[model samples]
Target: MFSFFESQRLLFYYLGFLAFALAVLTKGIAGLFFGPVILIYALINKKLIGLLKNPHTYISFLGMAVLVLGYYFGREALNPGYLEIVSFNELGGRFEENLGSKKFGYWYHLEGFKNYRFAPWLLLALLALPLAYYSKDDKLRKLTTLSTLAVLVHFFVISSSSTKQPWYDLPMYPFLAMLASIPLWILYSALQKVNLYSFALSGKIIAFLLLVVVFRAPYQEVWDATYKPSEPPWNYETMGSEHFLFNVLYGKDNLDKAKVLHLGNNDHLRFYKKVLAQKGIEVELIEPENLQSGDVIVTCQAEIQSLLNENYRLELLNDSSVYRKYRILSANRKSPIDHR
Candidate 1:
């Protein structure tokens, strides 16, 4: 995008359109903001008329349409109603109603900046905006305008939607980082003007130290999140147990022939099913009454005791905090020893 802004070559325009199409393909309609952002920037800079007169712009748009719409057309051809399902379930449904009860106010993303992850850079970005806007440099002003537009456009669009996730705010970070660099650059330039050798050296040292101070918190956050993640507050042991169970069964003998029954409500059942399917394993949801000899049951702790009370002899295979894996040794028969 920066390259396109610097050079209005037809090749750059094509590359930009291709990139826009790829972004949309990768993340769905969230990527459509690219067009509106560029259009708005051109209008703000009084370049709309010029862009309209440029023939290559239309050619680029046509190419992008073929690339993006072709995929949608092929998908719809293969599975009729695919686009309709996506329109309702993945696109418009998110805006019209809260899916999965993930409702949050419009200020959710805006408030997220106050969190530890973004707070440090966000402050610098905010301070840099005014300085960048009033600067005499033409290129700096344009870059700042573009970054600001991208941030605002993406922020409002996602924030207004009923369905929200933390990752939805990811697209805004690059632009915010771009904006944040302006203030750092200004400080570096100011420090370079110190007249005395000692003062200049001291100023450079101070600037370097300030840069380190500003980056320390976010860097540590990245390190901890990647290498030494702390446990989430929510109870995720059941889900973790499912993953552990799958890992244990992944290479076991006759896994493909095993009748695996998942009991109780598990929200990620579909995802886990797909993952297991790739490993030649099939899992089904079954009730406690459906227990049969030789059947394997993956259930939570709440259901284990009741199965045992029903006179089903279950052999414990593995256990996690809230989930258990068991094989039915005998169904509708009492065992001499308590299995629980």
Candidate 2:
């Protein structure tokens, strides 16, 4: 959008406003920062007055407002308090309070660049900024200025927020990558000059090698996360229990009649319950006092021990480290309970 505005592409500028509206819908208020970013660019370029006088700017603003407000208002009408929830929980709370246990200082995201979160690219991007800003090409300098402004504005806004999450830094990566590309292209061009015993490698060969070196770690990381089978513990007990439930629900003998009960509350259990529901399995929450014969229970080791101490006989089905599955056989009422 900034590029289009810079190049005086009026049609694309209007379309960019609509695109910005979609971005806001997809990412909540984080997308609103783009407006301030562009305004800052206009001010820096001394085009603020011209931009304000442009009637298409007002028309574009109206279009964007209609698209964004239509969805928000429609949702609020259907679900009362939706706007309040979004404003308070999603936006306002993040700015005013620490919402999670894993809180970090303001420099958290900035430190991530050194800690392999952005890595290699972020360092190179920082190095390229000065060169990009002072480039002989007018277009390059303009773009560098705009991108630098965006990165600075976004960084400050997110870093100043009281609540922080790793994924919240996602939007900044694209602009950083744009900055990084200048140095990468320069390196690729330099690589093209390499000679081995009077033999010159083609630009294509250099580019291919450069790409392989650049992408290898990220590619391997993606492959390991998605396709590779995870080892125990890292597989997470909740995930293992999800697999166990899948097998039981679709077993050859068809234990479809078995009552599946989740015996305790945990973050993982709550999250995977939704995952299990998506696969057509329903897990009911059951208290220890409600234990009944033939009920298939899913719980942690401590809860299982508590059940055993209460004289409830259970046949262990599967144990996934922290979590376990068991079938209640009987409760021996006459037996003395072990307080220990």
TM-score of each: 0.72, 0.74
lDDT for 110 in candidate 1 is 83
Model 2 segments beyond 4 Å from truth? Answer: 99-102, 193-201, 229-238, 246-289, 293-296, 300-318, 321-323, 326-340
Q: Write the per-residue lDDT of candidate 1 for residues 1-340, one digit (tens) a residue.
A: 5566678666777888889889888877877865788989988888889889988888888988898889988999999999998799667897788877566888888888768547867788888779987888889889888999899999888888888887888998899989999988888778656556556487777777777987897789889999986545354434544554455455533332334444456656667667777766676756555566887666654545574547777787766554556777876764443332
Task: Give every collision pair in model 1.
Answer: none
lDDT top scorer: 1
How many pairs collide in each candidate, listed in order? Answer: 0, 0
- Evaluate all candidate structures by whole-model CA lDDT and list the values in order: 0.73, 0.72
Mark the 10 consecutive residues where model 1 has the least summed lDDT: 252-261
What C-alpha root-mean-square deviation, in Å, does candidate 1 show against the real structure?
A: 6.5
Q: Tell me the deviation in Å of residue 172 in model 1.
A: 1.5
lDDT of 2 by residue, 1-340 (tens): 7767667889788878888898899988888876788898888888889889999889999999999889999999999999998898667897888778378898998898657777767778887777776667677777777778888898898888888887777788888888887777767776777775666666557777997998898899899988974545754433544554545546522334444344344455556456667777665655555666777776544544575646777887766554566777888765444333
